[model samples]
Target: MILREQLITQGVSEKLLDDVEKFKAFYALTDQNLTSRVPQTETVFYGKDIWAMCISALLEEENILLSGPKATGKNVLADNICELFGRPQWNTSFHVNTDSASLIGTDTFIDNEVKLRRGSVYECAIHGGFGVFDEINMAKNDALVVLHSALDYRKIIDVPGYEKIGLHEATRFIGTMNYEYAGTKELNEALVSRFMTIDIPQIKEETLMVILKNNFADANEEMLSQFAGVFLDLQAKSRNSEISTKSVDLRGIIGSLKTIRRGLKPMLAVDMGVIGKSFDQYEKEIVLDVIRTRIRESWEAEDIFPER
Candidate 1:
């Protein structure tokens, strides 16, 4: 992999390249060096603009927080940024139980003596990797207080019992959250001020179709288009408040198409792909009717077996 400086020279943003270089140098002296960078992420045409903007901010003095509903590709985008910058990714999936001790390293007993074992965030920061805070809003706000100083202008981390360390110039945190969903809280102002928030809206039908066309080379184009229509129908229902589900993920539809192409019963594919995982029972029943009606009418013409 080329160094961050090389990537910049190759027409990538100077700011982003510099951040990558900083990460490499910072991690080189730490025990948690990833030893390599992320592979070049295949960028989706639909997200290029947003991705570039986010990368530019990350390179300068800002972090990014991606806000969206489920399946909006938040995590995927974060991973892609790390790849584009040739930086290793350190993913930390946040949950209610996550604590500062979990974000930074903790002292634990080893050989009857205390030894420091680095947490996901700390190790990644020291090693110059991108730290992806997945589903960050699910974590208790108090747990993230430790990150305030690290993320802001201070740009340093103080580990009281161990050492006060400064952040690696390359280290940046990209947090992902689904704020519209239940149980998610407002990102605290203190934390919010530190990041450049990018609101990830529902993906376009054309973009989703492109993803399916590219991902499944053998998939029939007609079927792919039909699937995209089905996804939009579901999304429309959600927006109109006629459905309780928040979104119909294009990736799920693609997976369903793959299953059907592999000879799984189409209804069974819809059941696993579109149903059984979202909304409450009444709403789910409504969605099931929609899926069955659409798949049966559209695919049965292709001799795809209908649901019993």
Candidate 2:
């Protein structure tokens, strides 16, 4: 109810909300064991339009590919989608070593005979869970071949030596990719064609403020503004190629604030959470320069959450 009301407050369409409610009831989970797969997400995605787009696409059974740079909340939105719709989620991060067996099933010896140990994708498919393919572009092209059948219109899994099975009606897949990451490539045309792409954008300052306030109601308002300013400055610089995306991190900012509430110095927490994210000493210096423009090195917990 809170999630739905939050969406309504954000100006999500009533018609869409109605459909979402219906969709939730219509495909309600029957298998209680899968309840653990439902994400316990703390952050609600803030974009009205993005929420509507993802809801509509998923309601129509289309696969989603969230494409963009870091800190854009692609994975967050994916989690919000699955949580709002009451679906179990299976997340897999792609890498060079990822292969068909890792996604489908591998042969295992059981009861003195060989049996298949189901993988994340297979579990998601058979049980109508949401498959979150993180770093989809990082995997070698050959490693992703196993997903082709399930991703396209076919929506079937043909596991060798196992019975072919159709995806559960409630099954949905959401893939996230960062285009310029090392060892990553643009998704192939064939793979791209299977998904309805959503290009996530950086969080607006106002949106970031709302997220911050929601997470830290007791934090000083002025301090919140300064932290938000720091993030916005980094985001703008990163966008303009003045700085790398390594330091334009919304998650890092939030995490650092949490540590600040736990009695760490405000600037030092930012250093570990935000600045230290980039291992390159030169990049760290550059990010610290941006942060110091907003956060004072002498700031402490009393300066941020003085009421405590």
TM-score of every prediction relative to native: 0.82, 0.93
Off by over 4 Å in 1: 1-45, 110-113, 278-281, 297-308
Q: Please, what are the lDDT tens digits per residue for candidate 2 over residues 1-308?
A: 47888899999998998998898898898777888778877778888988888889988889999988777788888888888889999999998889999999899999999999999999999999999999999888887877899998889999978889899988999999988678997678888899999988778978889989988999999889999998889888888887788877888999999999999999889988888888888878888888888988888888999876
lDDT score of residue 12 within candidate 2: 95
lDDT of each model, Cα atoms only? 0.73, 0.88
Positional deviation of 173 in candidate 2, in angstroms?
Answer: 0.6
Candidate 2, 144: how far from true, in Å?
A: 1.5
Give me candidate 1's TM-score against the actual structure: 0.82
Q: Which window of 10 residues has the lowest lDDT sum in candidate 2? A: 35-44
On the 0 to 100 scale, the lDDT of residue 47 in model 1 is 59
Pairs clashing in candidate 1? Answer: 23-170, 27-127
lDDT of 1 by residue, 1-308 (tens): 33333344334567555665675454453333453546455433245556567867876758899987777778767876776566678888888899999999889999999987889888877776788999899888998999998898888888887777788777888999997666676678898888999988878876677677766656556666767777888988888888866337666786777688777766778777888667688888878777765677334323432231
Total residue pair clashes for candidate 2: 0
